[model samples]
Target: MTSDIFAEWLKRQGHLVFKTKSSYWYSQAARTFQAFPYHRVIEPDNNEINEFLKEHNGVALRYSTPLSAKYGKISYHVLFTQSTYSIEGLPKKARHDVRNGFKKAGVEPISFERLAVEGWELRLDTLIRQGRVRAETQSAWVKQCRSAQDLPGFETWGALVEGKLVAALIAFSGDDCCSILYQQSATDYLRFGINNVLTLAFTNEVLKRSDVSQIFYGLHSLDAPDSVDEYKFRMRYTASPVRQRVVFNPRLSPLFNPLTYSALNAVHKLLPGNPTFAKAEGMLRFSLQGKKPLAEQDWPLGLLEQKESILKQY
Candidate 1:
């Protein structure tokens, strides 16, 4: 899809959209937003990116292009192609999960316009609490979802067992891609593997639509939990490493570099039960960064073009 279309979509969801010589930015508030450079067609020069970064004051800035590494460090994500959705292409375990999920019940497309907001909120809140999702993040998600429910081309689907909603999936459709924005399952029915079943059904439905080319599974870091990483791999999704940089305001650079963040993350992994430390670290990381623009630096100019060519094979 064109940057203009995407920008408009973000605006409909309540973000403030603005453009610069090298990038398009969308923000919901003063200290948070994401920037997408004009890199889909032409490479942006350092001056343009610098100018774009200088205008924003956020604790951390997220850049969405594959060229993120040139400015900072990289994070990888999974994007599924049509071939990856075929039953034969899935790993044995994943195939089994999908089959078992399907046997329980089928997924059906649902109109977000018809869903009761209060009911959806109760279900979402319960999922967040059970999954231990951060409260601030959960709040933001609920707000966004509520606002975007009636947007054009947005789709929501769910699976029911004994006439009760057990799992749900939400996606935004674009000209050439569909992004799975949110997927959740009821905590009480975790054993049913409803999430996997819903995903399989969604993939199948997307494949039938000739206009869609791929599915963006969202951002994933190499340092993510092992179970999460493994589940994606088992489902036959491949991680395409992107130059993802989280530009930290200069004031917070010393405490938020890749090395420091990685070390802190590793420590958290080792001490899984320490929510106190996790909460404290998250606050400190954002607080020390201040209200400066987070800029990604050191991008290799031609790497994104080369990577795109290579990715086309999948």
Candidate 2:
């Protein structure tokens, strides 16, 4: 895909993506690996990302691994906001109080049409100020937009405050489903409950359309140390699994697996404070831990037998 096309597509969708000078075509030409490489997936800089995609069809994407039923898996948290008006056990009074709190805090619903491109830019600036989007992720996202502009169907929604961008959500709408792709909110705005407000607003928007049946909250990681579970539940979104796979291409040699594992351990030990690693590792461990024999209290998602399949192949 041409970088120019991707850039225009994302801009049209109201994403705050900044393109690089180099194209994906040029980066692919420089690759030495034969179908596979031993390097771990690292967050590449804006320049590095654009350069890398230059080789891989000039598109950027993310994927997870697939697992067998015997090994166990988690379910992808698929919540039907239309039917999910209430959470399983959360008190109705608590939901009302939360909505009241949001209104009191100046949280308001905003249509996607009302959220202009400038609002997205402003929101991104707020994120940078709060140190949410690192330089690498930011760059990769821009390139990704450039690559996906030609995609058949895409949708987006967002909310603003005082003429400034506060919260936004982007997704792809299919025949009967909506898959959330990304979400962002200014750190300061999050304190004002814009995240929750935007979520409810967006869900309301989708629910209004008879064609849309369910909202895929994407993947949830029990591994998240950040604990956004309660918040997602508050929005009436259920917890589901997304499977992650790690593979060593046979052509790369037999030692690749052992070497990769060792390197990962070494890197984790070297940078225990890295937020990205924590988020990634948290998801992996959450699934693995669920399969082992443990006391009821020790298991977070209750037990594997108590619920439907949570493991999902993304």
Candidate 3:
């Protein structure tokens, strides 16, 4: 997909994104604090990054994979291939849970041409408050979701029990890939494994499409919670390390060092209920300076190789 379209999508999702002469900016704000997830550079080089850093008063910019290693640090993500994945590929326990979930919920998955945005937002908000959904929601996000029905390649797949929506997946299809951008289910149905059922149903629907070969489930770090990581692993996603970059503001150097960041992160974990404080803490941690630069040559060639293997299997 073109950066222009992706940037527009980000805006539609309530992120403050804009294109610069040489890069795309994704500005994130929490309360009164502002930060950038990373600048997407058209032609990434040391000079371009330096220029961008200068423009942003030395705020760090994140880039993906190989280029990130050359210009920053390394991170990782789990990728799920839709073409070769099926319910049978999941772990026995996971498969059983999904099957049992459908039986218990007494509902079959349904594809929706469009779902009511306000209702969807209310369900999502309820899930978020219960900590079942990790994503933060804003008022603008709900407004954007309502407007997104007119956007190309955007779709929502949902499951209802006796006419009450229990689970939903918001997806976006690009030229060659389909991404599950957001997912939520009612907290009351967690025991019934509605999350698993929704995922399976959504994947099955995507598999029916002839245009997409891969499904991107966003990012997952090695240190991610066991519940989430294991769920994705059981669903047969392949993990690969991708590079990430951070450039700290020189004036705030002391507060943005690794040691300080780790300590603050510990404190932040204790204050989960205070999102404004948590977000401020995250900004400091994200802007921390790495002790050493990652090696550039160690790009995850295995990710590409794995993708090729999956294609061959198909």
lDDT score for residue 232 of model 3 = 61
- Ten residues in sequence with the least summed lDDT for candidate 2: 32-41
For model 2, residues 1-314, the per-residue Cα lDDT tens digits are: 33344335544544433433321112111121111110111222345443444533332222232233222233344355455453223457445544643563443434444444334554465446534433234444555444444465455555555656566666666546666756766666555666666676667667777777878764544233224445665566764433332221223325434345456556655766554554434433433443443332133442243333322321
**Candidate 3 residues 1-314, lDDT tens each?**
44556567677666666444555667655312122222222335666655655665544454443433434333445566646556788888888878878886543433433354434654565546455344445555466556556667877777677777777777777756787766666767777777788777777777888888777775532122335545666667665555454555445555666677677678767866555546556445433422344432232333444544432532
Tens-place lDDT digits, model 1, residues 244-284: 44454555557766567567767866765455445434433
Model 2, residue 101: C-alpha shift (Å) = 6.3
lDDT of 3 at 50: 58
Tally clashing residue pairs in candidate 3: 3
Q: Per-candidate TM vs. native?
A: 0.70, 0.56, 0.73
How do these models rank on lDDT, best leading? Answer: 1, 3, 2
Clashes of each: 7, 17, 3
Point out where model 1 deviates above 4 Å.
1-9, 28-30, 36-44, 64-71, 114-131, 136-142, 221-226, 249-314
Best model per TM-score? 3
Clashing pairs in 3: 38-62, 60-247, 75-242
Q: Which number leads on lDDT?
A: 1
lDDT values for all models? 0.57, 0.45, 0.57
